[model samples]
Target chain A: MSISCDWPQAIIGVLLSQNVDLVAHVPDAGHAALIRLAEGHDQIDVVTLTSEEEGVGLLCGAWAGGRNGVLLMQSSGVGNCINALALPEICRIPFLTIVSMRGEWEEFVPWQIPMGLATPKVFEAMHVEVFRATEEQHVAETVDAAGDFAFTTRRSAAVLLSQQMLGAKQFKEG
Target chain B: MLERRTLVDRLLRHRPDNALTVSSLGSPTWDIASTGDNPLHFGFIGAMGQAAPFALGLAMAEPNKRVVLFAGDGELLMSLGILATIANKAPANLAIVSLDNESYGETGGQSTATAGPTDLEAVAKACGFSQTCTATSEEALDAVCDQVWTAKGPAFINLKIVCGPSPLVFPHSFDGATAMNRFRDAINKLGQTQGSYGRSNESEI
Candidate 1:
C-alpha cells in the first residue's frame, strides 16, 4: 500500500531489506507514515520512546542482544541525543537514526531552526557521519548505503531528511 | 534502609546463569564489580540515563535470557521518561533495580528527587510494569528477591539504600569497545548453553 509520503515508504523498504528488526522512535508528524508501516510489518518491532535519547541506548542494547535496530526522530530531537551518542562513538556500536528535518529556510516555526541547522555539526562532533536527502528520489538509496556502512563498519550514521522534501509547515496568525 | 553494596553482592551471589546484567556508571557499576567481574556484565563507561533502556533492548533481543539493570536513583531521574518507555515495551526478560539511596553517591551524596516526593516503584507501577516493589530492609529484599530473577516482568524494585560512601570496585576496563565486544560475543556464542557465557576468542581488553 502507498501513501502520499513516498519517502517514508522508500525508507521503510530500505530498512526492511537491511534486516533491521527493532525501530525505536518518538512520535513526529513527518514520521507518522513510516512509523505506521514499521508497526504493521511482521519483521520489525516498534518501540515507542518518551524521548529520542532512549533510542540510542536501546539500539546499542539491540546490538548486544544480537539484533539490528534503527531510531526515528525529528531534527529537534537531535539535541536530546547528543550526549547519548557517546556510547556508539567510544564502543563502536553500529546504529542508525533517520531524522525528519524541520526549521529550514522557509520554516514557519523559529524554534526548530537552531537544532535543524546545527544537526549535522552536532553529529560530526560525536564522530557520527551525517547523510542528507533533500530529494525524494534519493532518500531510499542514501539511507540504504548509509545503513549498510554503519552496520558493517560498526559505526554510527544519521540520515537527515530535509524539510524541502517534506514540504513546508505553514504557521497561521489568527 | 538496606545497605547498597551488600544488596548488590547478595543479588549477584544468586544471579541466574541465563541472566545478563547492565549497570549504570559510577556507584552501581562499582557495586557490581565488587562482587566479581563476569563476562556477562555490560558496564557502562558513560551513558548516564541509558541503563534501563539498554537492558530493555537486550531483553527483547534475547528473549531466552533475563536482563537486569542496576542503576542509581539520580541516574534514573535523568531519564525518568525511560520508565514509561520500558513499561510500554514490556520486555518479560527485563527487570530494573534502582539503588535508591535518595542521593547521588558519586557527587558527595547530594539529595535527589527520590529523596523528596518521588517514588520510583510507584512510577514503575504507574508506567504499567507487571511487577513493582520497594524494599527498605534486608528482610524485605530477601522476600522479594526472587521476583527480580524469576518473576513475570518487566519488574521494578526500588531498594531504599543508605546514603554513604562505599569502596569502589572498578571494572577491569572501562572502555566501551571492549565491553561491547565481550557482551555481543557472549550473547551470540553463549545462547545454546543456557546463556552462561564462556571464554571468547577475543583477548580481554
Candidate 2:
C-alpha cells in the first residue's frame, strides 16, 4: 500500500542540504519513506544503530570526517537522546535530526503520547532547537532550513515531521 | 587509584584554551573546577551515554582545537560501540578520559559493568585504541598524560577515580529553562564566531 506523496523529495532535499554522506537510524514505522529513500541512495552510507543515542555518536563521527549526516528516529527516541544531544550542543557540532513525531494528530498507540508530549519540552529544556513538519509541502523546505540552522548555529536542530505528513499508508504496509 | 581532585587539577593545567570538554553526569567534578571562560561544553542533561561522540563532533568542527571527553565508566559502558567508530576514523586531537568509579554513581551508586572486576583499559585496547592507560594513582596519571596526549590516534585514559557527589545540582529538576537558554546562547555565540557557515532564520520541523 504505497501512497503518492512528495515525502521522498523532501528527504532528498534534506540529504542534499546536509551533504549527508552517512545516514544513521533506528527503524520506526513512520520513517519508512525516508529510510527507503536512504537505502536507494548510493552516495550515502546508511548504518542501522542499536539505539537512538548511538545514532548521535554516528552522526558526530560522520560530521568529524567532513561528511554531513542525519539521525532518523521516532519522538520517543528523542527521550532516549536528551543526554546524547548534549554532544552536539556543547561541541558546537551542527547536528541535523529528523524525528517522526508520535501521540499527536493521528496517534493510535498510548505509549507514544508520553514521549510525544515530552519531546518538544525536553528539547527545549536541553536547549536544542526544534521545528515541526506538519504538511507534505513543507517537508523539503523545513528540512533544508533545519540543516542550515544546525550548520550555521553549530548546534543540534530537529525537524519533528508529523505522522500525518508521512501518512498512515506509509506505516500500514510496514 | 588517583583521587578525583588530582585528576581534575592535572586536566585543568593541561587543557589548552579553545579546547572543548564534555563531561558525563557522574562524580569527578572536572567540569566545575576546570571549565572557565574558555569554550567548555559539559553534559548535565539526561543521564545516558553521550560524551565521546559529542567530543567527536567538536573535534570535527574545530579540527585545530583539542577535544576532550570526561566520561564515567557507567556512561561509557552505555555506548561502548562509539570506541569502534572512533578507532576506525582516528581523530588525533580527540582524547577520551573515563573516570572509573566502579558504579553508576549518579543513580544512587547502582552496580554496572564496572562494579565487577572489569577492566576498561582492556576493553579500549580490544576496540583498537592505539594508546590505552589505566591510572590508579596520581603518579601513574601524570606519567601517562604525555603518552595519552601525544598519540597520533584516539587515546583512552581509565582513571580509577573515587566516587563522590556529582557536584552539579540536577539542572533539569529546576531552572532547566534558564540553563538551556544560557547554553543556547553560548553555542550560538561560538558558532557565529568560529563556524564557517552562517545560520538560517527560518524555523524548521
- Highest DockQ against the true fold, candidate: 1
Q: Check candidate 1 and list the clashing pairs.
A: none
Q: Which RMSD values do the candidates have, in order?
A: 3.7, 6.6
Lowest summed lDDT window (length 10), candidate 1 chain B: B195-204
TM-score of each: 0.93, 0.64
Global CA lDDT computed for model 2: 0.68
TM-score of chain B of 1: 0.91
Candidate topping TM-score: 1
* Candidate 2 C-alpha error for residue B199, in Å: 7.4
- Residue A108's lDDT within candidate 2 is 73
lDDT by residue (tens digit), candidate 1, A42-156:
8789999999999999988877776778999999999999889998888888879999988885788878889988999999998889998887788899999889878878889
> Which runs in model 1 stand beyond 4 Å of their true positions?
A1-5, A170-174, B192-205
Q: Model 1, residue A84: what's the lDDT?
A: 93
Q: Give the top-scoring candidate (lDDT).
A: 1
TM-score of chain B, candidates 1 onward in order = 0.91, 0.77
Fnat values, one per model, are: 0.63, 0.20
